[model samples]
Target: MASPARPEQNRVVGIALRLCAATCFSFMAASIKLGYRHGVSTPELGFYRFAFGLPPLILWIAWSRNWTAWRTARPLAHVRRAVIGLSTMLMGFSALAYLPLAESTTIGFAAPLFAVALSALVLKEPVGIHRWSAVAIGFAGVLIVMRPAGSQLPALGLALATGAAFGVGIVTITIRQIGRTEGTQTTVLWFTCLSVLALGTLLPVYGRAHDATTWAILFALGTAGGLGQLFLTSSLRYAPVSVVVPFDYFQLLWAVLLGWLIFADHAPATTWAGAAVIIASGLYTLYREHKLGRDRPKADAPL
Candidate 1:
């Protein structure tokens, strides 16, 4: 692949893959939601996702012969990411089962907002005022979604989504820490290895064995998850983060549509209303970042 042509091809591929990732992620949300009703524990469900997904990854590694990337200095960072990543995955699965997909995914999208705050704290980066306001509005949106005083919302599911968002946010932050020194593939590979090991240990003791249908859903969960991450990562090769990053929010639309058309999960009026706030606020933050430009330190500056 020549340099100029490679970039052009990558852009086309990136868009296609991201669209695919969005679809896969939405389907995964639906699958995990359905799987939970079959009495499958989160840990066990994880094992199925990772274990089934492992062979393809293994084959990719063998073909590429990039074994040394796994031994980077930040292996421990990868471990931390995996732990948080696993929690995020499990909580998401749990939320899907208990809450409407629209609500579950809408709340889960809060991770990016958390990412903004985490970048400032852990990265010691400067945040402009506009982004700060976005963070505030996004949280308010979250509160609206939760509707704490009202009984109509599913409290447990919302809590799970919050936990998942935080976990994923931490994972994202930690990735920034480690990814600077390590290849993304190395980081992701170790994450999968650590997560599978962690969950495998937990499953035997506490996980309930699932039926065939449950297993199928679990496989879909793993496949969709792996593919989504792959697409998202591949997308960076095409455009700058500023251009491609915001496209991530498109997942919300996919989730809402999938919930209604596939899983029969519908968002409450409040959920949609709050989502608008979150989106509006989040976009403001991105716009701030864009204005700040290349010279401005990223949300995660070096500690």
Candidate 2:
């Protein structure tokens, strides 16, 4: 088991991790966006993305030649993480298929909003009124972007994306709890193990490959996504999930830009407005956390 990082370095490391993860997720989202036009279903794309990427990860793990950290005290928990992760990817991609990329990206940003609530309940973390209020405001923005009341959208897309967020919160808290006993690399390796194995179950549906150009895009997606996971794991060593959570909304900015360039969709007024509200609320949450710290904590210091 890995020890907790010194509290002084937590926030610094966490922000770096969040920044990298945001980029990786944005890259992956872009790839998924491309795949959408190519007629690649989410499941098929995910299978290819993970499968092609695994051999290198495996070789790297084997080259390190130490299985000690790779072992987890709670194997079943890893299984659960894998399942939830698969659910998250599946739901997010499914949303991508139907919704405009920016809208899907914006709604998925609600994962942090979900995390605020879940962390309080499941992890028993102390979240002050300001954070709670931020959560409420964030949800209001989500409602505006989703406009669930205005139309009969696909219930499954909304439900699955939200459920995926709930699952993301669970995975996050689980990683935190387990971190008390696990090294960052060990934690990452184990989760990757479980994720690959679980995602493998969909092999039967893994469809035919597209042209070589599409293959290149998927490969880049896997590489960037893997690097993103690495940065995130390292950042968690220094910081609390709460500190890094909000930056994830940054992905929507990339999504919107990519949607415009690739799909030729002009940003609607509501999409941009809802995005501004969400980003504002998230910034407010970060401000409160930073201000309350009084003494500025190390970027890598965990809360």
Candidate 3:
């Protein structure tokens, strides 16, 4: 029999996988921006993102021999997740189309902050001062990024990105509710399949012919999204949630680099500063959760 890997080896593998997942997601974000620059509509991009992602997930389910994962008692819950999550996806894509890559990305990081408040209010989860403080600090970072009085960021994009974050928060709670009776595979698979169906119906309304280059970009976008989701799911199999999730912030670095190099979009210093604060606060929040015996993954959604 093969020897089992050491705990340290598992941690290293998990961290690497998490970093790869972040890179893939960051690449997907860049692809969305590039697709828009190539004249693709947000709805079309949203449609393809889920449609192409479905195959990989189906293959994964087959490979795992977990066909039972397709069974779910909570069809309505899946519907709610799919509808809300896809709406958030479109909002994020629109934000990418309108805002600098880094800014849109940074705003998305506020999901956990929103989750903190949502947990307290919606879930009736007790929130001590530590997490509440972290949430306050995290929002302060968001405000810094927003720079409400003298902001150069596009107002529409900022609003959309913030809305996406709040949507993510709501989705997080719904996921928690679903988790009470459903497996992760079931939730993810159902969401993707349902989203593909919903977005597919809109294809006639939003789809248009594209040049070969744009078509290639769309394919790349979908591929990156699928690979990112797979990597994120695989990482948790090797390591604890706390150990892997911190690597998610690596997406910010990838976003800054890709934005600057590909789109000539530079993130201002405030973006970096605010991102630092947000990341720090999020880490502290995670640490508090870990210490309190809570082990939920920070970045649960693929996008």
Candidate 4:
């Protein structure tokens, strides 16, 4: 058995891994936006992202000699996860094309809120007042950021981003349900493989020729995405959900920085304020879940 202090050390390491995952995900978003700027279509980008990402995951499985992870009794569950997850990726990358990175990222933060409601409606999970209250507060933050009446972001962009968040919430619930029987590698493997096959089929219709820089950007997107998944999986293995989840909010900061530096995009005061509210609500919700002894492993970054 491990020493009592061992868990504490794991928590520390998990926090670090979560932070790294956050950065990798932010970089993935930036790379997606960069790829779009170079004339890559969303479908093509999605195909490359998943296809290129597979090698790392495959190598890891081989290193661990966990070839059994490839075998699954839950093929339908994986197919369901893959379909929804691929839709989430397409919508999210599309949103990045139309919205500033910070704004799109802030909006994506609402996934946890959506997950809370879905838990009750779909999973028949009982949610207490505290979690419900947090959900409400988080949506309020979303409204503040959206300011639908006077918002400058294109309506389609907002719709896609919100849709992506909704898709993520569904993915989260599916993950929790299937997590009972699937190893982390199995889940990740199936999702990536299915996404690649699904998206790759559409490439001929949507794909465009890429220059050297664009090819590099696509490769970077895949690398960052694959590494991000790995880091997030490792983090959860090392620590409890409550301990490392809050670190995910750090992606907003990374998004802001990357947006400003790469795109010269600066979010207004309202966006920042709304992000703060969302972050606070999410942290509080996680805290409440922990207190209620209902904490569960959460999906990692949106990427």
Tens digits of lDDT, candidate 3, 1-303: 222232353988898999998998999999999999988998889878877777877876776767787789889989988888888888989999889889989989999889889999999998999999999999999988998888877899899999999999989888888888987778998888888788888889889999999988888888889888888977887898899999999999999999999989888889999999999999999999899999855334835
Whole-model alpha-carbon lDDT for candidate 4: 0.87
Candidate 2: lDDT over CA atoms?
A: 0.67
How accurate locally, in lDDT, is each candidate? Answer: 0.71, 0.67, 0.87, 0.87
lDDT of 1 by residue, 1-303 (tens): 111222453556656656776777777777777777777777776777777666656654555566664667766677777767777777777777678877776777677789889989989878767777788889999888888885476778888889888777777777777767776667767877887788788876977756787778888877877666666655666655566666666778887887788777677889889888887886777677677774221221100
Question: lDDT of candidate 3?
Answer: 0.87
Which 10 consecutive residues of model 1 have the lowest summed lDDT? Answer: 294-303
Backbone collision tally, model 3: 0
Tell me the alpha-carbon RMSD of every candidate.
4.0, 4.8, 2.9, 2.9
As a whole number from 0 to 100, the lDDT of residue 110 in candidate 2 is 65
Score every model by TM-score.
Answer: 0.87, 0.79, 0.95, 0.95
Error of 4 at 278 (Å): 0.5
- Encode model 4's per-residue lDDT on 54-119: one tens digit a residue: 888887677666768778998998998887888888999999999999989999999989999999
Off by over 4 Å in 1: 1-10, 59-67, 207-209, 294-303
* lDDT tens digits, residue span 182-205, model 2: 655565566566666666676667
Q: After the best TM-score superposition of candidate 4, give how far the Cα of residue 228 lies from its true spot, in angstroms.
A: 0.4
Clashes of 1: 0
Model 1: lDDT to the true structure: 0.71
Q: Which of candidates 2 and 4 reaches a greater lDDT?
A: 4
Q: List where candidate 2 sits over 4 angstroms from the true fold.
A: 1-20, 55-67, 149-155, 234-247, 288-303
